[model samples]
Each structure stands twice: as structure tokens, then as C-alpha cells.
Target: MNPVLPHNTLDQLFLSARTHFKWLPKPVTDEQLHQIYDLARMAPTSANCSPMRLVFVKTAEGKAKLKPALDEMNVEKTLSAPVTAIVAIDTEFYEQLPKLFPHADARSWYVGNQPLIDSAGFRNGTLQGAYVIMAARALGLDCGPMSGFNNAKLDEIFFKGTAYKSNFLINLGYGDATALFPRGPRLDFDEACKIV
Candidate 1:
């Protein structure tokens, strides 16, 4: 069996991690982005239908294209961050099922099923987005994930004529902890779970 992670590792990945709004002007390299995705992709997905797609906007021109799509509250922090990842879902992700899930003919299951396609794509893609965050944290990077943006506009600007649709955005870099607000409270397990 795999060993439990060390306390410090857990703390880095969860307990002490915060959503940062300010960055330290350090860059997140392209290699690090690739490492994040490489690690995240190894996690589970339904029928191996990995639908998540990412667009890392690190260039000034890319950020400029993305600016108008961001909500007012998200603009400054996102623009100032070293990298902002566009977490998206591929509507036609089943096309890769033959390669990703070679043991079964999974592609046929969603060939013309729009509802199933939408449901699986969004759910699995969002799960992968969470994996991305954990992977980034594991690699000593900070993340600020937010949904306060115009999805339709972002899709048009970044994914026009493609099968991809925006789900959320994550600003990534070394964070400015001095700018963090006090940590928020979480519900106790008793309040959020059941022993069924």
C-alpha cells in the first residue's frame, strides 16, 4: 500500500494553501506548466475520458486578449499574475476514448448523446481542474482559482470555432502572502458528512 503523506506535504497541498490575489512578480515557467499537467493527467477519470484542456496565458498579448473577458474584480490580479490558466472542457472528448480507454469502445456511448456528453465533459473536466491545483501546489506554486468571469466572452475570445468551453480560470505564481485575507472557516465533518 502507498504510505500516508507527511504532515508538511499535506499542509502544502491543503491545510495551509490559500487562494492568492496578489503575486510576487516571479514567472511560472513553461516546463512547470507541463509538469503540472503531466502529474494531473495521471489521476482518475471516468472511462479514462480526460476532457480537461488548459490554455496558459503568460504573454502580454495573451493577457490582453483575455482582459475584456474577465470580471472587474478579477482583472487586476489576473493580469498581474505570472500565469493564468484557462480551465476548459472539450465537448467532443470521447473521440480520444479509443486511445485513452483502449479496453472498451467508449466513444460510441456518447456519439450522439448531447446530454451525456455535456454532463461527463463538465464533471470530469472540473475534477481534473482540481487535480491541476493540487499538482501545482505539490510543485511549490500558488493558485488563485475564480469563476467571476464572462464565460461566453472568454470562450469566444480563446476557443472560438473549437470544441472547447471555458469552465474557470486559475492565476498561478509565487503568491504575496502579505496580501492574503484571514483564513476562512470550514464546516466540521459532522456538518457535511453522513455514515451511510
Candidate 2:
């Protein structure tokens, strides 16, 4: 069995990690982006139907294209971050199940099922987006995840002619602690879980 992770590792991945709004001037390198994906992609997905696709908006042109889609509250934070990841779901993810889940005819399972296709794509894709945040944190980066955006507009700008659909955005960089708000509270186990 795998041993428990060290305390520092756990802290980095969850406990001490904060959703950052403001970023330091430091840049997140391309190498770091690649490394984040290499770590995140190993996480499991149903039928290995890994539908998540990412567009790292780092350049000025890309950010400008993205700006018009953002809600007023998300505009400045998104623009200031070193990278904003467009966490998207590929609607046609089942096409790759033949290679990703070769042990069974997984691709055939969703071929004609529109509802299954939509649900599975969104579910697994959202999970992958969480993995991306953890991976970034493990690499000592900060994250600001948000859903306040016009998804259709973003899809038009970045994913035109592709099957990918935007689910959310994650601003990534070295964060400015001075800009943080108070940490919010969480529910107790009793409030959120059951022993059944």
C-alpha cells in the first residue's frame, strides 16, 4: 500500500493552499505548465475518458480575447495573473476510449448517447480541472479558480471548430499574500457526511 504523504506535502496540496486573486510579478514558465499537466494527467477518470483540455492564456493577445467573456468581478484578477487556464471538456472524448480503455469497447458505450456524453464529459473534465489545481500547488504555485464567465463566448474565441467546451477558469501564478481575503469556513464532518 502507498504510505501516507508527508505533512508538508499534504499542506502544499490542500491545507495551506489558498485561492489567490492577486499575483506577484514573477512569471510561470512554460516548463512548469508542462510539468503540471504531466502530474495531473495521471489521475483516474471514468473509462479513462479523460476529456479535459486546457488553454493557457499567457500572452497579451490571448488575454484580450478572453477579457470580453469575463464577468465584471473576474476581469481584473484574470488579467493580472501570469496564466489563466481554460479548463474545458471535449464533447467527443469517447472517440479516444478505444485507445485509453482498450480492455473493453468503452467508445461504443457513449457513441449514440447524447446525455451520457454530456454528463461524463463535464464530470470527468471538472475532476481533471481539480487535478490541475493540485498539481500547480504541488509545484509551489497559487490558484484562483472561478466560474463567472460567459462560456459560449470563450468557446467561440478559443475553441472554435473544436469539440472542447469551457467549464471554468483557473488563474495561476506566485500569489500576493497582501491581497488575500480572510480564509472562509468549511462545514464539519457531521454536516457534510454520513457513516452509512
On TM-score, the leading prediction is 1
**lDDT against true structure, model 1:** 0.97
lDDT of 1 at 140: 100
- Every model's TM-score: 0.99, 0.98
Per-residue error (Å), model 2, residue 146: 0.4
Please identify model 1 stretches exceeding 4 Å from their true place: none
Instruction: Write model 2 residue lDDT over 1-196, tens digit each, in one string.
Output: 9999999999888888899999999999999999999999999999899999999999999999999999999999999999999999999999999889999999889999999999999999999999999999999999999999999999999999999899999999999999888889999999999998
lDDT per residue as tens, model 1, 5-61: 999999999999999999997889999999999999999999999999999999999
Task: Give Cα distance to truth, residue 60, candidate 2, Å.
Answer: 0.7
Cα-based lDDT for every prediction:
0.97, 0.96
RMSD of 2: 0.7
